[model samples]
Target: MRRALHAAPEILANFVAPYGVYEMLAAHWGDTDALIASAVPPLLWSFYELAKTRRVDAISVVVVSAILLTVGATFMGGSARLIQMRDAMVTGVVGVMFLATLGMKKPMIFYLARATVARGTADGAAEYELVWERPGVPQVFRVLTLVWGLGLVVQTSCMCWLAWIWPIGRFLLLSPFISFGIFGLLMFWSLGYIARRPAARAILAR
Candidate 1:
């Protein structure tokens, strides 16, 4: 319960923030510029919070900043459909980044997982470093990263399709759930797959 409470703010920020802005903008203000202006403040607040938090990983800062920039551009010039489509681009960019890093010594997922699981604590950081060095460990993360990358791209494609064909209100209501659902499944599968791997199990047991 305590852990859940601790996570609530981030969870809300990630899942609810944009949707809330969109809803509010759609409700009171019909003008595009007004919608755009209203959207900026919440994102700025998010950026500020990300910068202020000592425990935040670098990736979080980068991701939030990317979101702010994308939102700004989308609102400044994009049509309603374009705004929706551009929003999906953020996830798409992450997918591209993941695939782009696959040829490197460390896959994108390695850094993401490290930032998530090993942030702030020295002991956790040491364990993550050792995990990446273990034989076959990188292979596991590489495969998982590939899955995640492809999954995100697939999600983006779906969002694009819906944005083009579906009502904006309906798309806004459903897209977040769809994104979370796909990611939850992928995360479950990746964790299960890793747990079954001998090398991954050994490292995780540490």
Candidate 2:
């Protein structure tokens, strides 16, 4: 087990080393189109869950969100300005997602965090609605929503900045440290918080 664990880093390094970024994500997740299909369910589940306790609202996101995004990027492709700041493209898409959910006063992050709530079975969509109506949940979700959206914006901006100033390979070197540091802090904070609650800690500790 120790030997296998030690080799895990090499396995990951080797996987990405030979492939382009798009290719790597595709292969890792089984295929590129699979990524989109995989992404939609969680958001949809969130809506379905929230809609029960809250009023019935429109869908938060759908095909147009993805297509129009690509279209917008395509229009600016030749502009060179878009190409350089093109990293912001995904950020814009995510911001739009938050906006779409904002109309319903639903924050997208809590959908992901629902598992942290007691008895949040991912398969049980109705339970998400139940969770949403719990005390202080919606407020926590909105803060989570803002944090998620703002964090993505800042992260994307940093990526663009790195790509602009650094050479191609350097961004890879720098990004991991920055990401690790941020996640490390969050993880440490969460560890303390979760440790205090046995039920919530079970979910988080997982």
Candidate 3:
């Protein structure tokens, strides 16, 4: 038990390193103590709960920062910049997570969405979503995934780019507006794409 406990950090470090965030976050937080404090709880409560002991040990650091930004935005209402930066942070984190999922060639979202759609909740009241996977939809599904990934990259890039060019205060102040705009635009674009897709239409009809 002591050996396992002693090895926990290294085990976590090794597991998460392949996902490409271990060093970046370590650098950002720097101090191991601080990093552990800030980073571990979220992972423990969120990701770790879903895994076996030897599986992935750490949640994405990007996710932690994103949570900080979101909480800060809510609490720091006087500072619109915090809110904008918050938007950026949240979007950036989500963007990276989605990209990582893509990189892994994992279909976490596709499966979850299918499960939700097909069965709804276990209770009888849930609307039945069509669970059928037609051959025709894979092409569009792939395209949609690409589009979503690209959209996240674009939004994160926008936030980071603004962070660089604008004064720190300005970036913070304007981020909310920019973030909200991007979000609404993304939604519209997604809606249009889905609305035109035969699979989506077929799903709706079912």
Name the top lDDT candidate.
Answer: 1
**Poorest stretch of ten by lDDT in candidate 2:** 55-64
Per-residue lDDT of candidate 2, residues 6-124 (tens digit): 76654444333323443445555543332232233333444444555442212223333544454455344342333425623565467557646655756665554543442334444
* Preferred candidate (lDDT higher): 1 or 2: 1
Tens-digit lDDT track for model 3 on 1-206? 99999867654443433223423453565423222333343345444434432322123343455556655544544333343445455666666556566554333334434443444334311342232355455444455556666677788788867855675434433454676677788768766876887665443332
Q: What are the lDDT figures for the candidates, one per model?
A: 0.73, 0.48, 0.50
Residue 82 in candidate 2 has what lDDT? 38
* Per-residue lDDT of 12 in model 1: 68
**Of 1 and 2, the candidate ranking higher by TM-score:** 1
lDDT of 3: 0.50
Model 1, 1-206: lDDT tens digits are 99999777765665566566667677666534433543454466667677676565647855775676677566656577777777777788888878888999888777777776665566775678778778888789889879988988998899889888987667765777888898899988987998888778644443
Identify the runs in model 3 with alpha carbons over 4 angstroms from their true place: 1-65, 68-90, 103-108, 111-120, 123-132, 202-206
lDDT of prediction 2:
0.48
